[model samples]
Target: MVDADQTFVIVGGGLAGAKAAETLRAEGFTGRVILICDERDHPYERPALSKGYLLGKEERDSLFVHEPAWYARHDIELHLGQTVAAIDRAARTVRFGEDGTVVRYDKLLLATGAEPRRLDVPGTDLAGVHHLRRLTHAERLRGVLAALGRDNGHLVVAGAGWIGLEVAAAAREYGAEVTVVEPAPTPLHGVLGPELGELFTELHREHGVRLHFGVRLTEIVGQDGAVLAARTDDGEEHPAHSVLVAIGAAPRTALAEAAGLELADPAHGGGIAVDERLRTSDPDIHAAGDVASFPHALFGTRLRVEHWANALNGGPAAARAMLGRDVVHDRVPYFFTDQYDLGMEYSGWAPPGSYDEVVIRGDAGRREFIAFWVRQGRVLAGMNVNVWDVTDTVQRLIRSRAQVDTEALADPHVPLDSLVP
Candidate 1:
């Protein structure tokens, strides 16, 4: 074991990095831990940025993972407003910014996280076109929405991922006229399969939001340096006062690549390659969160998930591995989104093209239901819409790897609790 004074350096002060620092302390490692964040604030929650926070229903302080005092109380060094310029793995140090302040680490965690993927289409640089990845971006969008007087404000959300839908819901709640444009046939088609995808599409449309599917955006039209509309590939121009680009995120792996770490397949989408224990090819450097791709037991392929739960759970798992603890990092991945009076929760892993049966447990038409994606008599994944209790039972079933009865799962008369392992 290394000396207690051995320094631990964590890059990126987002959810994963912050949690890793907290976990290191919790694991009784009284080491010299330094958290380097590009932003000025202490780590704050990002999920709420597109939802309650953006709507002004939540304060900035409320989003903080821990208060500014907590970091001090824990005695964790906070290096704010410093971007890691390069990682010198051979030298066991990281150079930050132009001044090149070097931080030496015995062990390093690359929780560099991800950045919003921008569209290369014309007029993307328009003033009103924005991406909601960071708190600042959300703040800017919120300010514009509030200034425009949400009521009857025309807002076009280009992309139909969780971020896009959540932002669209918030804009609608403020009485904005919202239009969601998605290139896919259904929103969340890549994540949620067809049956659940159809449910989400219907859910958004029911809430008075216009939904356009199977159409690609060609350009963001501008007037006087501000966005005016979005031109589609189908030769359609949809007018809007503001536009949000929520086309998903690309892993922030530049520093890792610079350090000569093995990168995962771009088809797996530019995440760092790591073993089950979250150890990167370098072994001394570990990666987790959206930046790391590991083999999934359920999917049987290397996968990367950009969910809040992964950062929450995986950060601690990596810390344990660093401490030489035998910890299996397998758990049901979970994510939730609140949109249009619907609380959507999903858990477990969905193998691609493996769900042969979809069993609905509640009324989809009533905007409340749990849909189970079953393959080979086992529950691979499940989607819950306003039926959160079912998620607990699904987690248990997934952990136990239990065979689920299709008829019982589909039967609304049966309690989901009855299916628990």
Candidate 2:
């Protein structure tokens, strides 16, 4: 039933967009495929921007999702360095670039992704103040970190989120002085809650990273168009040669908004509203990755996930749904972080009010343990720190939604799989 003359257009050239195009071809869709990207570089994953690539452990060529010739070889039209200005739902066309070239599509996929939130204080435009969301930003920050290391320069990181902590670790590895400022009581306060958050605070302290909690960055003071210090609400000035604003990110839904597409409520981490099949209000248009907010059946809530794994799996799920195949994106929310000698993987959603108690297995003092957030005896989420090959067990515990005894869950000798039945 393939429509050979139909055209499928994908906007954004990140992991989700590229993967969706590849999925279409792999599924034997002989239709016209077009992909548009605002960045000049080929599609790439974003994890390396804060991990190996930033630390100089990964080569530049490893970032791209495909080689430059891959698209042409597969007969996929790729338009790089082009931004879509408008989306015409009625005409099924998208206008982009200075010349306003319009492309028609029978089916459309929006993988626009998200943009990093900017610091709203004075001197943010000054040199040495950085934000890491794109490859260009990471490339510049990598060199800045090396120079800072050689000069023993001080780096003031605003917000102790994943990006901030990862960059801080990379900076420490490069021998640069790092100071992280967070308004919360601990690092990763929103994600891990205070209980496990304290563990991260101790980890960074052991690695010589200065942490200032219960304080927000008020202003960035600069001299000669370069950052000099970061002023905090706690009435302290931290001397800084460079500043990093790793606050958070907002989904890029401007095009969807202008086109009058239904969007999720802002309180629910707003993005383009989609069903379980990733289809928008207009059936011809679908969305995936960070920009798509869909109802999660297991969590019984609408969630917009911005992690790398979501993009890795959501793209193909959306592609199959586009091809008239039944698809439901119900993967458990997952993410990971590496700081210093510790590596951790988190599965399931356990926001502050959702989980009543947290259970820990193994020893926290040794930084080798698994933590589970439980609500009324049902496991809601789990995190394994410095634990190996247990992701499957952790995710199974979450998906099973089985009531587990607190003592047994906390016992390291107890097999996790045995608790499910």
Identify the leading candidate in terms of TM-score. Answer: 2
C-alpha lDDT of candidate 1 relative to the true structure: 0.85
Q: Please give, for residues 116-205, the per-residue lDDT of candidate 2 as tens digits.
A: 898888889998899998999999999999999999999999989999999999999999999999998899898889998999889888
The local distance difference test score of each candidate is: 0.85, 0.93
Candidate 2 Cα misplacement greater than 4 A, ranges: none
**RMSD from true fold, candidate 2:** 1.0
lDDT of 1 at 395: 81
Please provide, for model 1 over 279-335, each residue's C-alpha lDDT reduced to its tens digit, 9 standing for 90 to 100. Answer: 999988999898989877766778788999999888888888877788767767789
